[model samples]
Target chain A: MTINSKIQNINCCDHIARRVGDIAPSGIRKFFDLLASMDGVISLGIGEPDYPTPYHIREAAISSIENGYTMYTPNSGIPELRQELSKHLKNTYNLDYADSQILITVGVSEAMDLAARALVNPGDEVLIPDPCYVSYSPCVVLAGGVPVMIPTCEEERFEISAEKIEPLITEKTKALLIGYPANPTGTIMPREKLEEIVKLANQHGLIIISDEIYSRLVYDCEHTCIATLPGAYENTVFLGGFSKAYAMTGWRIGYAVGPASIIAAMTKIHQYTIMSVPTMSQVAAVEALRNGETSAAEMVADYNRRRLVMVKGLCDIGLSCFKPQGAFYAFPSIKNTGMTSEDFAHNLLMEEKVAVVPGNAFGRCGEGYVRCCYATSLKELYEALERMERFLKKRGASQAATFQV
Target chain B: MLNKILRLLEDDGRLTPEQIATMLGTETSQVKELITQAEKDGLILKYKAVVNWDKIAEEQVWAIIEVRVTPQMKAGFDAIAERIYKFPEARTVMLVSGTYDLAIIVTARNMHEVASFVTHRLAPIEGVQGTTTHFLLKRYKEDGVVLDDKNKGMRQKVVL
Candidate 1:
């Protein structure tokens, strides 16, 4: 059949479900698709680290498969994995939780979806910071909740202040979703900011969902958990994964820790839905959280080195960057270029073949800026900088004249 | 008198000679002379009312692309860079000093088109190194004023 005839026979209207409107394609995924076909493109757009999964972690997965441990794990997760996760939380963030408060998920992505479904009632409002993780809003919407975005500014290094968050609350505001070591912008909340939010949540009786997937990837400061703050442990649901620190994006393993009540609700939903994370992945993650400290240490050290280089490089190149307190990413202002974030990023890709995510992609506040992930090798990082310099020299005339070239 | 009229309209072209003379208390002949001089100096190219497209609802997709490239190639960085800029996906380009060399902006109907550009068009070019792609997770304000925050939360939410 001809293409037109095939199209005619298929009922496009019938195939499109109402949920499709509620669930739109991710903007980050869209850009990756564009980059797939283009030649000579250098990208700092994806949040995932470029490092290979550490050898020991890989071996653990291999060992699981070899030992015939490929069978399904417990609905909550393997006992050892949950225990390790529990221990890691107490050790790192001073946040205590029993294994029962944790549920191993396919990834933090799954944890986010499950949490939304478990907590959000239809039409309930979820207060997500503007320029948040791409997954949060969609997940909230899919769970039949409304996403109310709260704008954060660059002056605050994109860190949402509690004062800014307090007034948005209402009777219908069911939860507050916050991510630190933020993806598009490498901003992390200080203890003071978390304290304010914690207090406010307590006042309004709000649920606090913390996406701390980038916790171990922090460069400048230590990763602190809001759950550690007094009174927050019961209200906050902590989301974490082995992806950034262990460079295990493909492993698809993460866990959530929260109050026993919410944890029970999430586990019930998870049991009926995803069942459990892949057995090998759980094995790998357990190894990562427990025995993978050396690898995490080395990787974080390398990222810190690259982070310094990248932030300095962007500054030297005139894309002013605020010193990122945590995370191995830099969100640089592109305002001097006289172009929108999308325009700046597109031009950089087209002209210099260098790719960065536009600030606007994260939210309107991200306009006139772009995000650069320094989770790459020193060699790739420097070379990408050189190409960017040349491109900006030609495109950004005022800034170009200062270049030695 | 003619200067006052021009200043009021911000340009001589916006008003006919008769209108300007009536408004400024000047003769039509003098108004015409002032218009001719302003045009000769290249101060005014054309007079048109600026249209704010933001007011209209349009199906628009925006993306920020991170790109990597080899600075010094066998042929030179310019040729490879040129190839990247030539693609329709590129709307803006900049060379940055960081983990990646160049930052690009691209727009398309959907995610598939952006992906095609990366895999099919970009990665294969000579001297083209590596790339990590990030799609916009959310947007708060685009040009200047708040765009997405219909709810007033001074503190923004971002997940890196």
Candidate 2:
């Protein structure tokens, strides 16, 4: 047979698993692709911090390499990193986890995947707050589990209360995944609200995977680690990383802490798949945990400053924004514009060269909102806000003319 | 809050009060008031650019002149320092605590100008006893700015 005929004979889709095919393409990808091709487009679409890793942390990684720490670490992670993470968790959130109970992975991204694969069984359901980080649902689905999105509204500051979650729990519900301070919405689940969820998780015998990547980026609020709650220690898998806090997205180092058995199970998969995180990154993470707190705090302060500017700018421009208490994003409602989130984002990108992620990229409930990250430089944020203002004015004028007609 | 605003201005003189207010999460009027107060109080002396003139084709000479001057009865080195610093050529004059009594940084059009300023102008002063001039060969850094390559090493745009 000819090459074309032979290739056609080997049905690629048939060979692929049905689970892989069932996974939808990421909603954020199209915007990212459009962003990549466009020049001079000010983006509030990104989720990571703009700052480089702190000097001391980078210095540590360099010294580690010079010291010939090029070999692979233990499958779980370097003991030093795990120890520092344990101490860090204890100091930051008053949560105590033994070093053995922590598994360092390639950022919270990998840890989220590991959590799903380790705990989820086929046909099991994992409940997640709607409009959360994009990876949570896909991770659950990829692990042979069904993802159940619990709808959260802006009136409640996008917080998922126990009232909404408790009724959704069925026998097949194996876990509840949550990230706070949450991405896309930039809302932190307050301690009192989390207590309700903890009670529900306990009553329903469900594991809670808490992604606390943005824990340190909170503005004027304390990030209460769900694992630190009274009865949550046994059932909660806490995922955190240096990416958001230390501005170390490129470092690709994060840790997961939980019950020893769950950690061991995660480690089993990690060993077979990832084997180990980079030794240099592990060294850098240790340095970040040890000496990078001040720098992290400073970045958080900067983000807080930018957050105020962004939220205020959005509101001033007639997009009603729910004040973000945590994370760097400002999710503003675009309902008054008489456009869908996608149309607003796309038209704004086309007309004014400002790129923002449509909130629906996170989930269905995010339809009339848009996510604007304030982690960019103050100058960029100012320019983006200016462009958005102009765009809004023009849109309003056109809408008014249409209404008159 | 005012101190924080001052430090930010000190780092980047181009930051407007509006920008500072936004970054500091304060009202623009408040930042304006504090900055105006600071200016009136002489807390912020002046805003000046730190220029690296070595990059230009025009030749400029800088010399560090160490002077040993007899101390005045009442004024000590302050009188002599004031005398030396009054000249526009003396970029900086300090009563140093080293082997030299007074250290003066002199800038001129050329080496000859600097040498002449040291010999005919600086050394001829009443209290001056001896002089040693060291001409600066190159400036690696000036006022916390590296004078080497101008490129800040552009950061790669990352997407998550």
**Which candidate leads the pack in lDDT?**
2
Chain A of model 1, TM-score against the native?
Answer: 0.93
What overall lDDT goes with each candidate model? 0.78, 0.87
TM-score for candidate 1, residues paired by index:
0.68
Best by TM-score: 2
Which of the CAPRI classes, incorrect, acceptable, medium or high, describes model 2? acceptable
RMSD of each: 23.0, 4.1
Model 2 residue A84 CA deviation (Å) reads 1.7
In model 1, the runs with Cα more than 4 Å from the true position are: A1-10, A24-31, A397-405, B1-160
What does candidate 1's lDDT look like per residue over A10-120, in tens digits? 977678867656475656565556666676555676577766788888998999999999887899999998888888877777777887798999888988888999999
> Tens digits of per-residue lDDT for model 2 on A358-399?
889889999999999888888799899889889988867222
TM-score of chain B of 2: 0.88
| Top candidate when judged by DockQ against the true structure | 2
